[model samples]
Target: MSTVVEILTQIRPEFDFSQSSDFFEDGMLDSFDLVTLVSELDKAYGISIDGLQIVPENFQNVAAIEALLSRNGVVP
Candidate 1:
């Protein structure tokens, strides 16, 4: 999962992925952010985050995102 941090950092190094939980609510991840994140996640985890998984609740936080990734066998 640490690699996930690396990937996130590569996407948005300014954001603190560790303490960040309100990715959507807090405006940390906007529409453009989601697009970038999805792209990076697709490449890093080898799983495509299609429109079906692009929901507010799913990508709201790191845990939620990780859960979604894990469900698709992307993260462990």
Candidate 2:
């Protein structure tokens, strides 16, 4: 999940993603950040994340994000 952490870090370097799980609720990620993250994830993982999957739960944490990617056919 280093790649996922890398993407998150690239978006917001101030917060420590490794120590957090509430990216959305804690204000670590706003809608604009989510959009940028989605774009980066699509390019990095060759996966498309849209529609309902754009919800906060999917982007709440590293594990949740990984689960979303897996559900979208990405191995990890």
Candidate 3:
């Protein structure tokens, strides 16, 4: 959980990371946010997230992001 929090914090420090579901509803992250996040994740986690994988379903919230990372064998 801390790993997820750390990642999310690095991406958006202003976000209230305790509530992962509110990320989109609160407009905490936009399209460009996803792009930057994906790049960061690729470098930080040593995993590549292709263009097709960059969808709202995969990046809507912290849990979703963590799931995506987990699927790619990332620690988070």
lDDT against the true structure, per candidate, is: 0.76, 0.89, 0.78
- Models 1 onward score TM values of 0.81, 0.90, 0.80
Which of 2 and 3 is the better model by lDDT? Answer: 2
Model 2 CA lDDT for position 18:
80
Off by over 4 Å in 1: none
If the candidates were sorted by their lDDT against the true structure, best first, what order would they fall in?
2, 3, 1
- Please report the candidate that would top lDDT against the real structure: 2
Q: Distance from true position, residue 61, model 3, in Å? A: 1.5
What local lDDT score does residue 2 receive in model 1, on the 0 to 100 scale? 47
Better of 1 and 3 by lDDT: 3
Q: Cα RMSD (Å) between model 2 and the true structure?
A: 1.6
Per-residue alpha-carbon lDDT of model 2 for 1-76, expressed as tens digits?
Answer: 4489999999999988888889988888999999999999999988778787888889999999999999989976
Clashes of each: 0, 0, 0
Cα lDDT tens digits, model 3, 1-76, are 3466677688889877777685666788888877888888888777898778889788887778888888887767
Q: Which ten residues in a row have the lowest lDDT in candidate 3?
A: 1-10
Q: How accurate is candidate 1 locally (lDDT)?
A: 0.76
